[model samples]
Target: MLKWLRPLVLLLLIGLLGIFGLRWTQQNMRNAIPSANSRVSPIILVPGSSATQERFDAMVNELNNKTKTTSSLLKVTVHTDNHLSYSGTFEPGRSHPYIVIAFENNDDGYSNIKKQAAWFNHAMTILSTRYHFNHFSAIGHSNGGLVLTRYLEKYFNQQKMRINTLMTIASPYNFSETNIDKRTQMLTDLIHDNKKIPSNLVMYSVAGTENYNNDGTVPFASVEAGKYIFQKQAKNYTQITVTGEDTTHHDLPQNGEIVSLIQQYVLHISDTKQRPDVNVRH
Candidate 1:
Protein backbone atom coordinates (compact mmCIF):
# COMPACT_ATOMS: atom_id res chain seq x y z
CA MET A 1 0.00 0.00 0.00
CA LEU A 2 2.82 2.42 0.84
CA LYS A 3 4.62 1.69 -2.43
CA TRP A 4 1.42 2.34 -4.47
CA LEU A 5 0.69 5.56 -2.52
CA ARG A 6 4.18 6.91 -3.27
CA PRO A 7 3.72 6.44 -7.01
CA LEU A 8 0.31 8.14 -6.89
CA VAL A 9 1.72 11.12 -4.97
CA LEU A 10 4.61 11.42 -7.39
CA LEU A 11 2.25 11.45 -10.35
CA LEU A 12 0.08 14.10 -8.72
CA LEU A 13 3.05 16.34 -8.05
CA ILE A 14 4.27 15.89 -11.61
CA GLY A 15 0.85 16.84 -12.95
CA LEU A 16 0.70 19.99 -10.82
CA LEU A 17 4.18 21.00 -11.87
CA GLY A 18 3.30 20.47 -15.52
CA ILE A 19 0.30 22.76 -15.23
CA PHE A 20 2.29 25.47 -13.48
CA GLY A 21 5.12 25.25 -15.95
CA LEU A 22 2.69 25.50 -18.88
CA ARG A 23 1.09 28.62 -17.43
CA TRP A 24 4.46 30.22 -16.80
CA THR A 25 5.59 29.42 -20.32
CA GLN A 26 2.43 30.92 -21.69
CA GLN A 27 2.92 34.10 -19.72
CA ASN A 28 6.48 34.43 -20.91
CA MET A 29 5.51 33.90 -24.52
CA ARG A 30 2.81 36.54 -24.24
CA ASN A 31 5.30 38.94 -22.71
CA ALA A 32 7.86 38.22 -25.39
CA ILE A 33 5.47 38.99 -28.27
CA PRO A 34 5.12 42.61 -29.47
CA SER A 35 2.03 44.76 -29.73
CA ALA A 36 -0.23 45.52 -32.71
CA ASN A 37 1.07 49.09 -32.90
CA SER A 38 4.56 47.90 -33.81
CA ARG A 39 3.76 46.38 -37.20
CA VAL A 40 4.49 48.04 -40.52
CA SER A 41 1.07 48.87 -41.97
CA PRO A 42 -0.85 46.57 -39.63
CA ILE A 43 -4.53 45.71 -40.20
CA ILE A 44 -6.53 43.22 -38.13
CA LEU A 45 -9.48 41.72 -39.95
CA VAL A 46 -12.27 40.25 -37.82
CA PRO A 47 -14.88 38.18 -39.62
CA GLY A 48 -18.62 38.72 -39.45
CA SER A 49 -21.15 36.42 -37.71
CA SER A 50 -20.74 32.69 -38.34
CA ALA A 51 -17.93 33.19 -40.82
CA THR A 52 -14.34 31.97 -40.79
CA GLN A 53 -11.02 32.90 -42.34
CA GLU A 54 -12.00 31.06 -45.49
CA ARG A 55 -14.75 33.58 -46.10
CA PHE A 56 -12.21 36.41 -46.29
CA ASP A 57 -9.76 34.56 -48.53
CA ALA A 58 -10.93 36.33 -51.64
CA MET A 59 -10.83 39.74 -50.05
CA VAL A 60 -7.38 39.13 -48.56
CA ASN A 61 -6.05 37.84 -51.85
CA GLU A 62 -7.42 40.85 -53.62
CA LEU A 63 -5.93 43.23 -51.08
CA ASN A 64 -2.55 41.51 -51.12
CA ASN A 65 -2.47 41.38 -54.90
CA LYS A 66 -3.32 45.04 -55.08
CA THR A 67 -0.71 45.93 -52.47
CA LYS A 68 1.93 43.93 -54.32
CA THR A 69 1.13 45.78 -57.50
CA THR A 70 1.51 49.14 -55.80
CA SER A 71 4.52 48.63 -53.50
CA SER A 72 7.01 45.83 -53.09
CA LEU A 73 7.97 47.01 -49.64
CA LEU A 74 4.49 46.70 -48.11
CA LYS A 75 3.53 43.18 -46.98
CA VAL A 76 -0.06 41.92 -46.57
CA THR A 77 -0.98 38.66 -44.91
CA VAL A 78 -3.87 36.92 -43.08
CA HIS A 79 -3.39 35.18 -39.70
CA THR A 80 -5.40 31.99 -39.40
CA ASP A 81 -5.07 28.96 -37.14
CA ASN A 82 -4.58 25.65 -38.82
CA HIS A 83 -7.62 23.33 -38.39
CA LEU A 84 -9.47 26.11 -36.56
CA SER A 85 -7.26 25.53 -33.54
CA TYR A 86 -6.72 28.73 -31.55
CA SER A 87 -3.58 27.74 -29.67
CA GLY A 88 -1.60 30.96 -30.50
CA THR A 89 0.74 29.18 -32.83
CA PHE A 90 1.08 31.73 -35.63
CA GLU A 91 2.80 30.47 -38.74
CA PRO A 92 6.44 31.70 -38.94
CA GLY A 93 6.24 34.07 -41.93
CA ARG A 94 2.60 35.06 -41.37
CA SER A 95 2.58 37.43 -38.45
CA HIS A 96 1.78 41.17 -38.27
CA PRO A 97 0.30 43.58 -40.82
CA TYR A 98 -2.11 40.69 -41.18
CA ILE A 99 -5.71 39.70 -40.50
CA VAL A 100 -7.10 37.54 -37.64
CA ILE A 101 -10.35 35.73 -38.32
CA ALA A 102 -12.22 33.60 -35.76
CA PHE A 103 -13.97 30.29 -36.31
CA GLU A 104 -16.19 28.56 -33.71
CA ASN A 105 -18.56 25.75 -34.55
CA ASN A 106 -19.87 25.14 -31.07
CA ASP A 107 -22.99 26.27 -29.23
CA ASP A 108 -20.98 28.01 -26.52
CA GLY A 109 -21.13 31.66 -27.58
CA TYR A 110 -19.63 33.40 -24.55
CA SER A 111 -16.54 31.29 -24.86
CA ASN A 112 -16.21 32.44 -28.45
CA ILE A 113 -16.19 36.07 -27.36
CA LYS A 114 -13.43 35.48 -24.82
CA LYS A 115 -11.48 33.38 -27.28
CA GLN A 116 -11.72 35.96 -30.03
CA ALA A 117 -10.69 38.74 -27.70
CA ALA A 118 -7.71 36.76 -26.46
CA TRP A 119 -6.62 36.03 -30.01
CA PHE A 120 -6.89 39.69 -30.98
CA ASN A 121 -5.07 40.79 -27.86
CA HIS A 122 -2.27 38.34 -28.48
CA ALA A 123 -1.94 39.51 -32.08
CA MET A 124 -2.01 43.14 -31.03
CA THR A 125 0.72 42.54 -28.46
CA ILE A 126 2.93 41.01 -31.10
CA LEU A 127 2.30 43.92 -33.46
CA SER A 128 2.79 46.57 -30.81
CA THR A 129 6.15 45.23 -29.63
CA ARG A 130 7.92 43.77 -32.67
CA TYR A 131 7.02 46.14 -35.51
CA HIS A 132 5.77 49.26 -33.67
CA PHE A 133 2.96 50.08 -36.08
CA ASN A 134 1.79 53.67 -35.91
CA HIS A 135 -1.69 52.95 -37.19
CA PHE A 136 -3.98 49.94 -36.81
CA SER A 137 -7.22 49.26 -38.66
CA ALA A 138 -9.83 46.61 -37.86
CA ILE A 139 -12.64 45.46 -40.14
CA GLY A 140 -15.41 43.19 -38.90
CA HIS A 141 -18.80 42.08 -40.06
CA SER A 142 -21.89 41.19 -38.03
CA ASN A 143 -21.06 39.94 -34.55
CA GLY A 144 -17.37 39.86 -35.38
CA GLY A 145 -17.48 43.64 -35.50
CA LEU A 146 -19.04 43.73 -32.07
CA VAL A 147 -16.31 41.49 -30.66
CA LEU A 148 -13.58 43.82 -31.87
CA THR A 149 -15.41 46.86 -30.53
CA ARG A 150 -15.82 45.22 -27.15
CA TYR A 151 -12.13 44.36 -27.05
CA LEU A 152 -11.22 47.93 -27.94
CA GLU A 153 -13.38 49.26 -25.16
CA LYS A 154 -11.92 46.85 -22.65
CA TYR A 155 -8.17 46.86 -23.53
CA PHE A 156 -7.61 49.96 -25.68
CA ASN A 157 -8.09 52.15 -22.65
CA GLN A 158 -5.12 50.59 -20.87
CA GLN A 159 -2.75 50.20 -23.83
CA LYS A 160 -0.97 52.98 -25.72
CA MET A 161 -2.57 51.88 -28.98
CA ARG A 162 -4.32 54.02 -31.55
CA ILE A 163 -6.95 52.73 -33.94
CA ASN A 164 -6.84 54.52 -37.26
CA THR A 165 -10.00 53.09 -38.81
CA LEU A 166 -12.76 50.78 -37.54
CA MET A 167 -15.32 49.55 -40.04
CA THR A 168 -18.28 47.28 -39.28
CA ILE A 169 -20.41 45.87 -42.08
CA ALA A 170 -23.88 44.61 -41.18
CA SER A 171 -22.95 44.49 -37.52
CA PRO A 172 -25.62 44.25 -34.86
CA TYR A 173 -24.27 47.00 -32.68
CA ASN A 174 -27.36 47.12 -30.45
CA PHE A 175 -29.28 43.87 -30.36
CA SER A 176 -31.40 44.77 -27.38
CA GLU A 177 -34.77 44.64 -29.10
CA THR A 178 -34.03 41.70 -31.29
CA ASN A 179 -34.33 38.05 -30.30
CA ILE A 180 -30.63 37.38 -30.64
CA ASP A 181 -28.93 34.51 -28.86
CA LYS A 182 -27.99 34.93 -25.21
CA ARG A 183 -24.30 35.04 -26.00
CA THR A 184 -24.82 37.88 -28.45
CA GLN A 185 -26.90 39.76 -25.93
CA MET A 186 -24.14 39.45 -23.36
CA LEU A 187 -21.62 40.79 -25.87
CA THR A 188 -23.85 43.74 -26.65
CA ASP A 189 -24.14 44.59 -23.00
CA LEU A 190 -20.40 44.32 -22.50
CA ILE A 191 -19.71 46.74 -25.33
CA HIS A 192 -22.43 49.15 -24.25
CA ASP A 193 -21.03 49.51 -20.77
CA ASN A 194 -17.49 49.85 -22.08
CA LYS A 195 -18.29 52.47 -24.74
CA LYS A 196 -15.79 55.32 -25.07
CA ILE A 197 -16.37 58.36 -27.21
CA PRO A 198 -14.32 60.96 -29.16
CA SER A 199 -10.83 59.59 -29.15
CA ASN A 200 -8.63 59.74 -32.26
CA LEU A 201 -10.51 56.80 -33.74
CA VAL A 202 -12.33 56.92 -37.07
CA MET A 203 -15.36 54.61 -37.26
CA TYR A 204 -17.63 53.60 -40.12
CA SER A 205 -20.82 51.55 -40.12
CA VAL A 206 -22.40 50.18 -43.29
CA ALA A 207 -25.95 48.87 -43.50
CA GLY A 208 -28.13 47.53 -46.25
CA THR A 209 -31.82 48.28 -46.92
CA GLU A 210 -33.33 44.90 -47.68
CA ASN A 211 -33.98 42.82 -44.58
CA TYR A 212 -36.29 43.59 -41.63
CA ASN A 213 -34.36 46.62 -40.36
CA ASN A 214 -31.00 44.95 -40.96
CA ASP A 215 -28.85 43.99 -43.90
CA GLY A 216 -30.11 40.43 -43.34
CA THR A 217 -29.18 38.76 -40.03
CA VAL A 218 -28.86 41.96 -38.00
CA PRO A 219 -31.34 44.82 -38.05
CA PHE A 220 -30.46 48.22 -39.51
CA ALA A 221 -31.05 49.71 -36.08
CA SER A 222 -28.21 47.61 -34.71
CA VAL A 223 -25.92 48.79 -37.47
CA GLU A 224 -26.97 52.35 -36.78
CA ALA A 225 -26.05 51.88 -33.13
CA GLY A 226 -22.52 51.00 -34.20
CA LYS A 227 -22.25 54.33 -36.04
CA TYR A 228 -23.88 56.25 -33.22
CA ILE A 229 -21.65 54.68 -30.57
CA PHE A 230 -18.52 55.77 -32.39
CA GLN A 231 -19.96 59.17 -33.23
CA LYS A 232 -20.51 59.75 -29.55
CA GLN A 233 -16.95 58.60 -28.84
CA ALA A 234 -15.03 60.07 -31.77
CA LYS A 235 -15.21 63.48 -33.38
CA ASN A 236 -14.39 61.89 -36.74
CA TYR A 237 -17.23 59.50 -37.58
CA THR A 238 -18.34 58.41 -41.06
CA GLN A 239 -21.40 56.37 -41.98
CA ILE A 240 -21.81 55.06 -45.51
CA THR A 241 -25.26 53.86 -46.53
CA VAL A 242 -25.43 51.24 -49.28
CA THR A 243 -28.91 51.26 -50.72
CA GLY A 244 -30.60 49.94 -53.88
CA GLU A 245 -29.59 46.40 -53.06
CA ASP A 246 -31.87 43.53 -52.14
CA THR A 247 -29.10 41.85 -50.27
CA THR A 248 -29.75 40.53 -46.77
CA HIS A 249 -27.45 41.12 -43.81
CA HIS A 250 -25.56 37.92 -44.49
CA ASP A 251 -25.05 38.86 -48.14
CA LEU A 252 -23.98 42.47 -47.59
CA PRO A 253 -20.31 41.57 -47.58
CA GLN A 254 -20.77 39.93 -50.94
CA ASN A 255 -22.66 42.84 -52.48
CA GLY A 256 -20.80 44.66 -55.24
CA GLU A 257 -21.76 48.13 -54.11
CA ILE A 258 -21.01 47.28 -50.49
CA VAL A 259 -17.62 45.89 -51.41
CA SER A 260 -16.98 48.95 -53.54
CA LEU A 261 -17.97 51.15 -50.65
CA ILE A 262 -15.54 49.33 -48.37
CA GLN A 263 -12.82 49.59 -50.99
CA GLN A 264 -13.38 53.33 -51.31
CA TYR A 265 -13.41 53.77 -47.55
CA VAL A 266 -10.17 51.84 -47.06
CA LEU A 267 -8.48 53.61 -49.95
CA HIS A 268 -9.49 56.95 -48.59
CA ILE A 269 -8.27 56.10 -45.11
CA SER A 270 -4.93 54.70 -46.33
CA ASP A 271 -4.51 57.72 -48.65
CA THR A 272 -3.73 55.39 -51.52
CA LYS A 273 -2.95 57.17 -54.77
CA GLN A 274 -4.95 54.68 -56.84
CA ARG A 275 -8.34 53.12 -56.14
CA PRO A 276 -9.42 49.66 -57.23
CA ASP A 277 -12.68 48.94 -58.98
CA VAL A 278 -15.24 47.43 -56.55
CA ASN A 279 -16.44 44.57 -58.71
CA VAL A 280 -17.11 42.02 -55.99
CA ARG A 281 -19.97 39.63 -56.75
CA HIS A 282 -23.07 39.27 -54.62
Candidate 2:
Protein backbone atom coordinates (compact mmCIF):
# COMPACT_ATOMS: atom_id res chain seq x y z
CA MET A 1 0.00 0.00 0.00
CA LEU A 2 2.82 2.46 0.75
CA LYS A 3 4.56 1.75 -2.55
CA TRP A 4 1.30 2.28 -4.55
CA LEU A 5 0.56 5.56 -2.74
CA ARG A 6 4.07 6.91 -3.42
CA PRO A 7 3.74 6.15 -7.21
CA LEU A 8 0.32 7.88 -7.37
CA VAL A 9 1.73 11.03 -5.71
CA LEU A 10 4.64 11.15 -8.19
CA LEU A 11 2.24 10.87 -11.17
CA LEU A 12 0.03 13.70 -9.79
CA LEU A 13 3.08 15.98 -9.41
CA ILE A 14 4.18 15.29 -12.99
CA GLY A 15 0.69 16.11 -14.35
CA LEU A 16 0.63 19.39 -12.43
CA LEU A 17 4.01 20.36 -13.86
CA GLY A 18 2.80 19.66 -17.38
CA ILE A 19 -0.31 21.79 -16.91
CA PHE A 20 1.64 24.73 -15.47
CA GLY A 21 4.23 24.49 -18.24
CA LEU A 22 1.54 24.74 -20.93
CA ARG A 23 -0.03 27.75 -19.22
CA TRP A 24 3.31 29.51 -19.03
CA THR A 25 4.03 28.80 -22.69
CA GLN A 26 0.63 30.13 -23.74
CA GLN A 27 1.03 33.28 -21.67
CA ASN A 28 4.44 33.97 -23.21
CA MET A 29 3.09 33.48 -26.73
CA ARG A 30 0.21 35.86 -26.11
CA ASN A 31 2.59 38.45 -24.77
CA ALA A 32 4.76 38.18 -27.87
CA ILE A 33 1.83 39.12 -30.17
CA PRO A 34 0.71 42.73 -30.19
CA SER A 35 -2.71 43.40 -28.73
CA ALA A 36 -5.55 44.81 -30.81
CA ASN A 37 -5.05 48.25 -29.29
CA SER A 38 -1.37 48.20 -30.16
CA ARG A 39 -2.03 47.18 -33.76
CA VAL A 40 -2.93 49.76 -36.44
CA SER A 41 -5.79 49.61 -38.93
CA PRO A 42 -4.66 50.99 -42.27
CA ILE A 43 -6.41 52.38 -45.33
CA ILE A 44 -4.71 50.74 -48.29
CA LEU A 45 -4.60 52.34 -51.75
CA VAL A 46 -3.84 50.92 -55.17
CA PRO A 47 -3.09 53.05 -58.20
CA GLY A 48 -4.26 52.49 -61.77
CA SER A 49 -2.26 51.09 -64.67
CA SER A 50 1.03 52.88 -65.44
CA ALA A 51 1.04 54.50 -62.02
CA THR A 52 3.46 53.67 -59.27
CA GLN A 53 3.09 53.78 -55.51
CA GLU A 54 3.88 57.46 -55.66
CA ARG A 55 0.72 58.06 -57.67
CA PHE A 56 -1.15 59.02 -54.54
CA ASP A 57 1.48 61.45 -53.29
CA ALA A 58 -0.41 64.53 -54.38
CA MET A 59 -3.60 63.18 -52.92
CA VAL A 60 -1.90 62.33 -49.65
CA ASN A 61 -0.44 65.82 -49.62
CA GLU A 62 -3.88 67.25 -50.17
CA LEU A 63 -5.17 65.07 -47.36
CA ASN A 64 -2.48 66.20 -44.93
CA ASN A 65 -2.43 69.79 -46.13
CA LYS A 66 -5.88 70.44 -44.84
CA THR A 67 -6.39 71.87 -41.37
CA LYS A 68 -7.87 68.53 -40.28
CA THR A 69 -5.89 65.94 -38.38
CA THR A 70 -3.39 63.97 -40.44
CA SER A 71 -2.26 60.36 -40.58
CA SER A 72 1.13 59.03 -41.68
CA LEU A 73 1.87 57.88 -45.23
CA LEU A 74 3.74 54.71 -46.23
CA LYS A 75 4.53 53.65 -49.80
CA VAL A 76 5.32 50.04 -50.62
CA THR A 77 6.19 48.83 -54.11
CA VAL A 78 6.34 45.15 -54.95
CA HIS A 79 8.82 44.65 -57.73
CA THR A 80 8.49 42.00 -60.40
CA ASP A 81 11.73 40.48 -59.13
CA ASN A 82 10.07 39.42 -55.84
CA HIS A 83 11.41 42.17 -53.59
CA LEU A 84 9.64 44.97 -51.80
CA SER A 85 10.80 48.57 -51.40
CA TYR A 86 9.22 50.86 -48.87
CA SER A 87 9.06 54.58 -48.30
CA GLY A 88 7.84 56.65 -45.38
CA THR A 89 6.88 55.56 -41.85
CA PHE A 90 3.77 55.31 -39.75
CA GLU A 91 3.02 58.02 -37.22
CA PRO A 92 3.50 56.60 -33.76
CA GLY A 93 0.30 55.16 -32.34
CA ARG A 94 -1.69 56.18 -35.39
CA SER A 95 -4.58 53.78 -35.60
CA HIS A 96 -5.40 54.70 -39.21
CA PRO A 97 -2.40 54.91 -41.46
CA TYR A 98 -2.33 55.15 -45.27
CA ILE A 99 -0.48 52.40 -47.14
CA VAL A 100 -0.08 52.56 -50.91
CA ILE A 101 0.89 49.41 -52.80
CA ALA A 102 2.15 49.49 -56.39
CA PHE A 103 3.69 46.87 -58.61
CA GLU A 104 6.78 47.05 -60.81
CA ASN A 105 4.89 45.86 -63.87
CA ASN A 106 1.95 48.21 -63.59
CA ASP A 107 0.68 47.41 -67.04
CA ASP A 108 -2.81 47.47 -68.50
CA GLY A 109 -4.91 44.51 -69.75
CA TYR A 110 -6.84 41.75 -68.03
CA SER A 111 -4.04 39.18 -67.84
CA ASN A 112 -1.72 41.67 -66.18
CA ILE A 113 -4.47 42.66 -63.79
CA LYS A 114 -4.70 39.02 -62.68
CA LYS A 115 -0.96 38.88 -62.03
CA GLN A 116 -1.13 42.13 -60.10
CA ALA A 117 -3.83 40.61 -57.95
CA ALA A 118 -1.53 37.72 -57.09
CA TRP A 119 1.32 40.07 -56.34
CA PHE A 120 -0.98 42.23 -54.27
CA ASN A 121 -1.79 39.18 -52.14
CA HIS A 122 1.87 38.46 -51.56
CA ALA A 123 2.46 42.03 -50.48
CA MET A 124 -0.57 41.89 -48.19
CA THR A 125 0.70 38.78 -46.40
CA ILE A 126 3.89 40.59 -45.47
CA LEU A 127 2.08 43.80 -44.58
CA SER A 128 -0.43 42.00 -42.40
CA THR A 129 2.36 40.26 -40.51
CA ARG A 130 4.22 43.53 -40.04
CA TYR A 131 1.27 45.74 -39.08
CA HIS A 132 -0.65 43.03 -37.22
CA PHE A 133 -3.98 44.46 -38.27
CA ASN A 134 -7.17 42.43 -38.33
CA HIS A 135 -9.02 44.77 -40.67
CA PHE A 136 -8.51 47.45 -43.29
CA SER A 137 -10.17 49.75 -45.86
CA ALA A 138 -9.26 49.86 -49.54
CA ILE A 139 -9.29 52.58 -52.23
CA GLY A 140 -8.57 51.70 -55.82
CA HIS A 141 -8.40 53.96 -58.86
CA SER A 142 -9.11 52.73 -62.42
CA ASN A 143 -7.49 49.37 -63.11
CA GLY A 144 -6.40 49.24 -59.53
CA GLY A 145 -10.02 48.70 -58.60
CA LEU A 146 -10.11 45.64 -60.81
CA VAL A 147 -6.99 44.34 -59.11
CA LEU A 148 -8.55 44.77 -55.68
CA THR A 149 -11.76 43.13 -56.79
CA ARG A 150 -9.89 40.19 -58.22
CA TYR A 151 -7.84 39.83 -55.08
CA LEU A 152 -10.93 39.85 -52.91
CA GLU A 153 -12.57 37.13 -54.95
CA LYS A 154 -9.53 34.87 -55.36
CA TYR A 155 -6.83 35.48 -52.78
CA PHE A 156 -8.13 37.42 -49.78
CA ASN A 157 -8.19 35.37 -46.58
CA GLN A 158 -10.84 36.65 -44.20
CA GLN A 159 -9.41 34.46 -41.41
CA LYS A 160 -6.43 36.80 -41.36
CA MET A 161 -8.02 40.21 -41.89
CA ARG A 162 -11.35 41.68 -42.88
CA ILE A 163 -12.03 44.41 -45.42
CA ASN A 164 -14.58 46.86 -44.16
CA THR A 165 -14.96 49.30 -47.03
CA LEU A 166 -13.92 49.53 -50.67
CA MET A 167 -13.94 52.76 -52.71
CA THR A 168 -13.35 52.58 -56.44
CA ILE A 169 -12.56 55.80 -58.32
CA ALA A 170 -13.29 56.00 -62.02
CA SER A 171 -12.87 52.27 -62.55
CA PRO A 172 -14.00 51.13 -65.96
CA TYR A 173 -15.55 47.85 -64.93
CA ASN A 174 -16.63 47.22 -68.51
CA PHE A 175 -13.49 48.72 -69.95
CA SER A 176 -14.14 51.53 -72.50
CA GLU A 177 -17.60 50.39 -73.50
CA THR A 178 -20.08 53.22 -73.39
CA ASN A 179 -23.14 50.99 -73.14
CA ILE A 180 -23.99 48.88 -70.11
CA ASP A 181 -25.95 46.66 -72.49
CA LYS A 182 -22.64 45.49 -73.89
CA ARG A 183 -20.66 43.74 -71.16
CA THR A 184 -17.01 42.89 -71.61
CA GLN A 185 -15.57 39.53 -70.73
CA MET A 186 -13.90 41.05 -67.68
CA LEU A 187 -17.17 42.49 -66.46
CA THR A 188 -18.91 39.15 -67.03
CA ASP A 189 -16.28 37.34 -64.99
CA LEU A 190 -16.44 39.94 -62.22
CA ILE A 191 -20.20 39.56 -62.07
CA HIS A 192 -19.96 35.78 -61.94
CA ASP A 193 -17.38 35.97 -59.14
CA ASN A 194 -19.46 38.42 -57.10
CA LYS A 195 -20.52 35.81 -54.59
CA LYS A 196 -17.03 35.60 -53.17
CA ILE A 197 -17.04 39.26 -52.10
CA PRO A 198 -17.68 39.74 -48.41
CA SER A 199 -21.32 40.45 -47.72
CA ASN A 200 -20.65 42.87 -44.87
CA LEU A 201 -18.52 45.22 -46.91
CA VAL A 202 -19.57 48.79 -47.58
CA MET A 203 -18.71 49.86 -51.13
CA TYR A 204 -18.59 53.29 -52.73
CA SER A 205 -18.18 53.70 -56.46
CA VAL A 206 -17.19 57.23 -57.56
CA ALA A 207 -17.46 58.25 -61.18
CA GLY A 208 -15.91 61.39 -62.53
CA THR A 209 -17.66 63.13 -65.42
CA GLU A 210 -15.91 65.77 -67.44
CA ASN A 211 -18.87 65.85 -69.80
CA TYR A 212 -22.37 64.47 -70.01
CA ASN A 213 -21.33 60.86 -70.54
CA ASN A 214 -17.74 60.25 -69.56
CA ASP A 215 -14.75 61.22 -67.41
CA GLY A 216 -12.69 62.05 -70.54
CA THR A 217 -11.01 58.64 -70.28
CA VAL A 218 -13.50 56.08 -68.95
CA PRO A 219 -17.11 56.17 -69.99
CA PHE A 220 -19.68 56.89 -67.31
CA ALA A 221 -21.48 53.73 -68.37
CA SER A 222 -18.32 51.77 -67.79
CA VAL A 223 -17.97 53.15 -64.29
CA GLU A 224 -21.64 52.57 -63.58
CA ALA A 225 -21.16 48.90 -64.40
CA GLY A 226 -19.69 48.54 -60.92
CA LYS A 227 -23.28 48.50 -59.66
CA TYR A 228 -23.78 45.11 -61.25
CA ILE A 229 -20.86 43.75 -59.30
CA PHE A 230 -21.29 45.33 -55.86
CA GLN A 231 -24.82 46.63 -55.42
CA LYS A 232 -26.43 43.44 -54.23
CA GLN A 233 -23.28 41.75 -53.02
CA ALA A 234 -22.06 44.36 -50.57
CA LYS A 235 -24.04 45.32 -47.52
CA ASN A 236 -24.18 48.95 -48.63
CA TYR A 237 -23.37 50.31 -52.07
CA THR A 238 -23.40 53.99 -53.02
CA GLN A 239 -22.63 55.45 -56.42
CA ILE A 240 -21.47 59.07 -56.56
CA THR A 241 -20.85 61.08 -59.69
CA VAL A 242 -18.57 64.07 -59.27
CA THR A 243 -18.87 66.70 -61.97
CA GLY A 244 -16.68 69.80 -61.81
CA GLU A 245 -13.66 71.46 -63.37
CA ASP A 246 -11.27 68.75 -62.17
CA THR A 247 -13.51 65.73 -62.45
CA THR A 248 -11.52 64.26 -65.30
CA HIS A 249 -10.29 60.67 -64.99
CA HIS A 250 -6.75 61.58 -64.00
CA ASP A 251 -7.73 64.57 -61.90
CA LEU A 252 -10.39 62.76 -59.88
CA PRO A 253 -7.90 61.43 -57.38
CA GLN A 254 -6.70 64.93 -56.50
CA ASN A 255 -9.96 66.78 -56.96
CA GLY A 256 -10.81 68.86 -53.92
CA GLU A 257 -14.32 67.48 -53.65
CA ILE A 258 -13.05 63.93 -54.06
CA VAL A 259 -10.54 64.57 -51.31
CA SER A 260 -13.34 65.70 -49.05
CA LEU A 261 -15.28 62.57 -49.94
CA ILE A 262 -12.31 60.45 -48.94
CA GLN A 263 -12.06 62.21 -45.61
CA GLN A 264 -15.76 61.79 -44.94
CA TYR A 265 -16.14 58.21 -46.10
CA VAL A 266 -12.80 56.43 -45.91
CA LEU A 267 -10.83 57.79 -42.98
CA HIS A 268 -11.36 57.48 -39.22
CA ILE A 269 -12.00 61.15 -38.65
CA SER A 270 -13.54 62.83 -35.64
CA ASP A 271 -16.44 64.07 -37.72
CA THR A 272 -18.01 61.60 -40.12
CA LYS A 273 -21.36 63.30 -40.46
CA GLN A 274 -22.66 63.94 -43.97
CA ARG A 275 -23.29 67.45 -45.13
CA PRO A 276 -26.79 68.30 -46.28
CA ASP A 277 -25.63 70.57 -49.09
CA VAL A 278 -23.30 68.34 -51.10
CA ASN A 279 -23.62 69.11 -54.81
CA VAL A 280 -22.51 65.76 -56.13
CA ARG A 281 -25.05 63.50 -57.83
CA HIS A 282 -25.88 60.18 -56.25
The 10-residue segment with the lowest total lDDT in model 1: 69-78
Q: Write the per-residue lDDT of candidate 1 for residues 132-200, one digit (tens) a residue.
A: 565567788777776787777665643366677778777666663353333345545664654553276
The digit string of per-residue lDDT tens for model 2 on 186-228 reads 9999999999898878999999998899999999999999999
TM-score of every candidate relative to the true structure: 0.62, 0.81
Where in model 1 is the C-alpha error above 4 Å? Answer: 1-39, 62-97, 103-111, 130-134, 157-159, 176-198, 269-282
Global lDDT scores for all candidate models: 0.59, 0.87
**Candidate 2 worst ten-residue window by lDDT:** 30-39
Instruction: Report residue 252 deviation for candidate 1 (angstroms).
Output: 2.3
